[model samples]
Target: MTQPSGDPAATGVPTCYRHPDRETWIRCQRCDRPICPDCMRDAAVGFHCPQCVQEANRSSRQNRAVYGGERSADPRLTSYVLIAINALVWLGVLATGWKNSDLIARLALVPKGTCESLSSDGYYPTALGERLCTLGTQGDGHWVPGVADGAVWQLITSQFLHVEVWHIAGNMLALWMLGPQLENVLGRTRFLALYLLSGLAGSVAVLWLSGAGQLTLGASGAIYGLFGAYAVIAHKVRADLRSIATLVAVNLFITFAVPNISWQGHLGGIAGGALVAAVLAYAPRARRTQVQALGLGGFLLVLVALVALRVAALS
Candidate 1:
């Protein structure tokens, strides 16, 4: 910046353009305009005049990502927030205890909750507003005493309700590892939508493939979705998928080999995530947003179809 000459009386003191009364020897680092201390704002390189600062800010914002997030903002912020929410939810569920609690029964998405059931063996206290079942009570189950009134919200809520610390920890670890890259590439809104939809799809899978009397809950479905998303993103960038495929294969093997794990949910979540990623990664830029919305909506409709079919099969 050009410094004000010391001969103030000869040429008058160089003053702030915005505050002419105040004399100053400083100039804006950006615009080189002489500014008083009050009008000056600290900047990366040096001080800036208020006008220059405003202009720079406007320009910076204009260069932000399509979703209005700064490119330089922490890419992991969305993932961190998701982890925090899941942790808090786990804490709440733990506080309530895993067994015989209305809180958990309300959250776990069970297919039987969506329809009339013959028995309530797998359900919580239905009298407490939980319309319960899941994979168990569809046709042959007994009306258990404690099942709650059934709710459709469980399909989504169940994804966030992990009763075990290891379960949530595993899921969060996977998220922390994979979420930031996708968030940075897809932006926050899209990443969140992908996550939620994938998880819901997983639940829907369980509803369709598992016995209506079976019970399931956790974030595994959503995390599986991220795995699929990471693969698709790699493909989009022309990166090799051998490693991602291997990781997915191992998880799939674990899903099938493990007892008490929701394999149906995991598989369904992966399929859902890959489908969504296909839409996001390959859509034409000219109408990308519209295509993405339609693709996701179509996926959701497919899930609804799956749920409806399950209900009919049991009905």
Candidate 2:
């Protein structure tokens, strides 16, 4: 039998067993094994043994499986696309000479005024509640009363109506940046549910807090909700907490510094997203799916109830 080539007891210099003449100064970072230059691969963090390189690749693939397979797959969340669509619609409205059209009046959540208009035109009331005061002059600069009537559908539709180009652009930018990662992690359905619910919660908060003085319209509520969800999930998974905290702080600063921004919507959306995330994250694994579904359903129902009450109150 051939004798081993290198001195086995040398310090600092690891002699290759196969080639005793060659000494290795670097240790493989992955396995901490002594390896010659011929058997080393440069990795992002450090050098790895050939065997460890293969194992690292294998582990990366396994983790990808839990993230819904292929790294290049499309995101489940559609918030970015939705933002684009809303922008396109705004442009189309401008192009069609409808820039000043009452599109928002028709689609936005102006509970009191909408209910009154519908009721006067023969719509039946659906719920019993106090009539909310309406703010701002309506079409042709005419003062309209009870614009704050609490219509639930407004909660969903309000997210699509922005008061200005800058408003929509800001919200869309945030959505585009944060939405893909969330959609990937939560899957499409859950991501969408969170967005819609957050928007509704924000609208509700505005109605409650402004109580008919402010005419609120924007997607910031939903966007803030996405941030809230990310923060909660990051904590639960022990992800990089610093990143989430930075995002929250930057957005909060903007909300406060900017004039005419809807702080109520931001707060409401954040609270709603965090609450839903907590419910989903803490439920028993077996019951988690059911709990998420039921929770979403209940939230939607409450939104509908609010809308009905607003309609009835105005009537």
Candidate 3:
């Protein structure tokens, strides 16, 4: 006997590197390692072993969006969730009694506390309620807390509130139309941050500009913010400007022309969105994420300071 050759190939049987028990003639194109059917992964040219495929994946770069955000697998999912929340809240408000609903009393953004009558028109002064008129004395009503009264939760909650069917309908329509497109470009996380901050900016504007007892509620402010953000992004990517400009102009007309509309909130939201979009779109690729985060943080601090200043002034 010639000592039966040392190589397994001498017996016309070569085992897979990963599975020694299985015999295979196929070899990985990259590593030239024998790969059994179980370990084989299809490649551009020939099959590759599991190890080689994983190595190739590890070395490959991840795909990113224009603003340096990771590409979202489903861009519309976030928008859908937001819509669901607003819808659920609207349904709850309807069930409770629309405008008379205690839910609205607690959620709507009231700049200053108001003594409202449940069975009558016109709000009474808090002092009058304590002296000449009480909750059940002159009328049936309760004292609704305002932002200045430490009802800070209203800043965000008011965004989801709506008493009119047309109001919620129009706002939800605009959101559905604009949200996914923006989310696709900026990714879910960035898009959501832009939305929430823009909405808060509107609330802050209400705190500063509207009458102390004025009631402001609806998603129009945030919707306007999206319009402004879309315009910035459109300009950044060099998309057509005519449509967005026309849309914005039309909305502005509606904001001012329509009675009871919060022009302050709309204008503030647009300005905030434009500033934020500029920060996100123009950040340098070098240290891009860090720069964006710092810029957003600075903007948030400015808003908080504005809120604090308003609170101090109220006090």
Best by lDDT: 3
Candidate closer to the true structure by TM-score (higher is better), 1 or 3: 3
| Worst window of 10 by summed lDDT in candidate 2 | 120-129
The TM-score values for the models, in the order shown, are: 0.69, 0.63, 0.82
In candidate 2, stretches whose alpha carbon ends up further than 4 angstroms from where it belongs are 1-73, 96-99, 114-152, 302-315
Cα error, candidate 1, residue 251 (Å)? 1.1
Q: Regarding lDDT, does 2 or 3 come out ahead?
A: 3
Q: Runs in model 3 with CA error above 4 Å?
A: 1-56, 59-62, 121-138
Order of models, best lDDT first: 3, 1, 2
lDDT of 1 by residue, 74-96 (tens): 77998999898888888887677
Span of 10 residues, lowest total lDDT, candidate 3: 123-132
Candidate 3 lDDT score at position 123: 22
Cα-based RMSD of candidate 3? 4.0
